[model samples]
Each structure stands twice: as structure tokens, then as C-alpha cells.
Target: MRPLLVVGGRELAARLRDGTALLVAVVAPIVLATLFGFALGGDDDPPLTATIGIVDDDGGQFPASVQREALQTEELRDVLTFAQYPDEAAAQAAVDSGAAGAAILFPAGFSDSVGEGNGGSVNVIESDESPLAGVVARSMVDRISSLVEARTYAVRASLEAGVPGDQVQEFVEANGAAGPSLTLADDPVSGGQVDLAMYYGSGMAAMFAFFVVGASARSLLVERRLGTLSRIRAAPIPGWTPVVGKMMVGFGLALVSMCATWLSSVLIFGITWGDPLGVFTLILGHAFAATMIIMLLASRAQTDSQADGYTLAVAFVFAFLGGSIVPVYNLPDFLQSLSLITPNGWISAGLTELAAGAGIGTVVVPALVLFGIGSVAGVLAALRLRKGLLS
Candidate 1:
């Protein structure tokens, strides 16, 4: 036990002392996380910025009140940039050329219909190029329609109560929509926060874990070439000592890599991980498990190049199957179910749950499964090391 610990300690210290390993295990993940978080718009409320073109063909029939109501939506204020156009042709031209995202054309009788409490339709033309812009245009149209309907209701109420026409119109104009025009119903309690963190963080961790295999395989090659394995085998230490040492060091590197990635996400990009303590344990445990598979690959490869090929193949294959690049939610059912065979898949799932505010207790099952994998690999590596079969 002491020999294994001593060997593991030396390997950890050597990784720390090596500038390249330190960069890969720590600095690289941090940089990648920071870059991706900002560029991809990490879970913080996305800034609303869309270009819109408005063409009022109704000869000023579209009420100023409708426009005001449309502008009042927080989504419009944050996510959309509105531009008024005189006609559909010009708006179409702007949209075709990519200058505008969507166009609104108010029909000839639009204002009179609203003024007279009659329902009518307007043309909302959106550029197929920008789905979000189309959504924004539709949303603005809904807000305008709802506000007008609400005002119509208020006016009808006043008339029912024998209020004067002028007073009723004034009341509807003044107080119809004093608050938010859009209420985001069905908004999850936590909003977009968890989804964003889980996807990026888990993907980053899995990708970097692949990188650790390279370092571990290199260290294994060095041991073989320098006769370190021969010397360790000749000593009165357990055959498993070297394998355990390598596994421990690789696991620690994986943990450090993931931690650095998450830290950069939280601090630099202002990403909010749901629960820090639970997330930390989930990441650390998964890293340990991932290193087990990496150690097995290291044992199988006779040369650094062989290890490199196997590591790349395994990492990419598993990462893809496991939802590193795409969420499991988007995957086909069979593929999603099949992904469980890979460590990356389970790790990704566990992290997703953690980001959704699940505690360590919720993550325990996956953790145990991952540990079971590590134990199995460790036993295999120990057997191979004892027989001098590790190449």
C-alpha cells in the first residue's frame, strides 16, 4: 500500500512538474471553457437582438397603441431590434438581403378594425434565414393582438357600465397594459441555467479526459523504456502497485482538468452551476472512472503511437455515443439507450442530473456503476502486470 502511494505521489508530482502536462491538465480546459461559454452564450439570459422591418400598409390604420404594446414586451426589448418600413416590397428586399430578419405588413383596415372593435388579420412575413427573428415577429404580433383585445374588452366593460365613449377610450389607452405584455408561462423554476451548464461542462470534461489518456500512455511508455517496470517488479512490492499508481495519477489529472474547466466557466463567464458541492463530487468520481478505461488502453498498447491511436478511437467513439457533442435528448431513442455502454454516456447523464440540482444521493447509482468499471479494469490491469504482459 505504501509503495503504491509513494509511486502515485511521485507520478502526480512529476505531472505537476512537467509544463506540458500542467497546461493540458489545467490551463487548456480553462481556456476552452471560457471561450465556449462566452461565444455560445452560457446559461445567463441570452441578449435579445433581432432585426425587424415593419410596413404599415393600412394608411396609418395601425394604432400607435399596438406599436407601443409590442415594444413593451421584455422579449422585444432584449431579443429584437425593430426597424420600420414603408411597404412590403422594401421590407422583403431588406429581408432577402439579410438586413432585416422579419417584416410586418398591417392590412388596409387594421386600425379601423381595432378602433371599431372588429377582429382583422395582418401579414407577418419572416425571412426563412432567421428562425429566431421569425419567432420574435410572431411574438410581437401576439402581444399587439392580445393588448388590442384586452383594450376592446375594457372599452366594452365601460360601455356596459354606462361610461362615456371618450372616457372609456381614454381609460383603455392609459391603463390597458401597465405591466408586462408577455408572461413566460411554464418557465421552469431554475430557467435556462442548468441546461447550459450541464451540456458544456460535461462535454468539456469528456473531451479533456481523452487528452489524459495521451499523457497516461506516454508515462506508461517512459516506465517501460526506462526499466522502471522491471525494477518495480523485482522489488518486494505488489504486482498491482505500478498499475494502481498510474490509475491514481490519471484519475487525478482528469479531476484537475475538469475542475479547471468548470472554474473558468463559473468565474470568467459567470455561469451558475446548480450545486457546487454535488457537482464537484460528480465530476471527481466520473474522472476517476474514466481514468480506469484509459489505464486499460495504456496497458494494451505496446508503444506510445499505438496508445495514441487506441485512445483517440475510444474517446471519440464514446464521446459521440455518449452525447458529448449533442444532447441525449436530441438523439434517437435506440442510440440514446445504447449510449449507456460507454463511460462518457453515464458521466454526461450524471452531470446533467447534477446541473438540474440533484444531490450526491441522486448521483450515487451512476457513481457506483462507474466505480465498478474502475474496479474491473484495475483487476485486469493487475493481472496483466503480474504476468509481465503489459506492453
Candidate 2:
């Protein structure tokens, strides 16, 4: 145990002295995360705003109701503005000239048609440059149309139920005044909103952790090439002692890289990771997994160059497949399932949950899975090292 610790300490000291190792492990992730965060827009940016044109040819209650209730609602006032156009041609011109993102044209006699139980046509004109604005306009018109339809149905039902003909207009007006029974309310699951900065920061950290540990593990090949391993073998140390020591160095470097990235992300970028315990647990698990996998890959290589190649290949594969490059939520369903196979995926998910205000308990499953994967890879790496390096 003493020999193993001495060997591990020596390797760790050597790694700390390597300028390239420090840059790749400690500096690169935070720098890239800052760039990504700024590219995605900051929290200080203004809210979205769009203009919608209104063309009411019918001059009826339905169009008036839409203008009063849907377009001018307090909730939408900050994001949407309305302009009244004299005719459909003027509204279309407004949309084409970019004065308005979209337009709603209520055709002549539209209310009469709706009142007569004949569905009326409502035309929506959308700007080519602002498609989302058009979508919002269309949704608003659709909601008004639904309300009109509901009132028409209620009027027809009252007439059929033996109500006097003179009272039917009263029923229509009353039903139209009453809004839809079911209204949607927002219920956020977590207190903290996970911004783009935190997401890419965590992902960059997870992806680079592989390279950090890989460099440490590949040092075995470096020592072998320099004939240092031969001299070390002549000592009274056991064959497995050097391998265990390298593994320790790899694990230690992995933790350092992850923690450094985390600190930089918070202090420099002002990104909140949420739930300190959860973040640490995820970091520990991912570091263990990264070290084990890099060790396994390094064990299969014959030379330092070959080990570097293997490390680069595996690091990129895991990074791409894992949500480190593209978010898992945006990926296709099949690819999302494939992410579960990588340690990067597990850590990214756990960190994401934490960012979204989840408790420490939420990360337990991910941490356990990471540990399980590391254990399996560690066993395989030990066996391979014993057969190849120890021999």
C-alpha cells in the first residue's frame, strides 16, 4: 500500500508539472463554456416583441371581442402590439412591409354567417421573415373562432329547448361574454431556470474530463517508452503497484479538472449549478468513470502515440453521443437512448437536473450507474494491465 501511494504521488506530481496537461484539463473547458454562453445570449437581453395587424371588415362583435380579450390581454400586452388596418389590402401591405409580423382579416358579414350557424372564414396573413409571429396570430384567431362556435352551439340548443325566439339573442350574448371553462396555468417543477450557459458549461466540463484522465492513464506508456518502467520494475514493488498508482493519478486529475471547471463556471460566468451536494456527487461519479474508461483504453494500446489516438477517438465519440455537444432533449429518440450508455450522458443529465432545482436525491441513480460502469471497466483494465504491462 505504501509503495502504491508513493508511485501514485510521484505520477501526480509529474502531471501537475506538465503545462499541456494543466491547460487541457483546467483551462480549456471553462474558456469554451464562456464562449458558448455568450453566443447563446445573456439573461439581460430584452423580451420578445411582435406586431399584429387587425382588419375588421365585418365591424362585428366577434372581431371586437378578439381585439378586447385575446390581443389586448394584460399577459400578452408586453410581447404583442396591435394595429388596426382599414382594409385587407392595407393589412397585407403592413405584413409585407414589415410594419406588422402578421395580420388577421375578418371578411364582411362574418358575424352574420356565424350567427346563422354557417361557419365564417377568417384569413391570416403572415410575414415571411417572422414565422413565429404568424403562429401566434393564428393561435389567437383560432381561440376566438372556438369561442364563437361554442356560443353558436349554445344558442341553437336554447332555441331547441322551447325558449322563445325573442330571448335567443340574449342567450347568444350571455354565452359569448362567458369565456372558456378550462384555462391553462403554468406550474414550474423547479425554482431555478437552467440557462444555456450552465448547460454548455457542465457539458464542456464532462467532455474534457475524459481527456484529463486519459492523459494521466497514457503516462504509463510514456514511462514505458522512456525505459522508466524497467527501472521501476527492478525495485521491490509488486507488479500491480505501478498500475494501481497510475489509476490513482488518473482519478485525482479527473476530480481536479471537474472541480476547477465548476468553480470557473460559477465565479466567471455567474452560472448557478444548484444543490451543492448533488453537483459534487455527480462530479465524483463521472471522474471515477472517466478514469476507469481511459485506463481501459490505454491498457489496450502498444505505444504512447497509439494511446493518445485511442483517447482522442473515445473522448470525441463519448462527447458527441453524450449530450456534451448537442443537447439530449433536441436529439432524435434513438440517439437519446444511446446516450445512456456513456458516462458523459449520465453526468450531464444529473447536472441538468440539479440546474433545474432538483434535490440531491435526484442524482443518486446517476451516480450509482456511473460507479457501476467504472467498477466494470476498472476490473477489465486491471486484468489487461496485469497481462500486458506487468508481464
Q: What does candidate 2's lDDT look like per residue over 132-218, in tens digits?
A: 466567667667677667766766787888777778767677655344522112111111136667777878888888888877777
Positional deviation of residue 223's Cα in model 2 after best superposition, in angstroms:
1.7
Q: lDDT tens digits, residues 274-324, model 1?
A: 567766766766686677677677777777778778888887788788877
Q: RMSD in Å for candidate 1, one decimal?
A: 9.1
So what's the TM-score on candidate 2?
0.67
TM, every model: 0.60, 0.67
lDDT of each: 0.69, 0.79
The TM-score leader among the candidates is 2
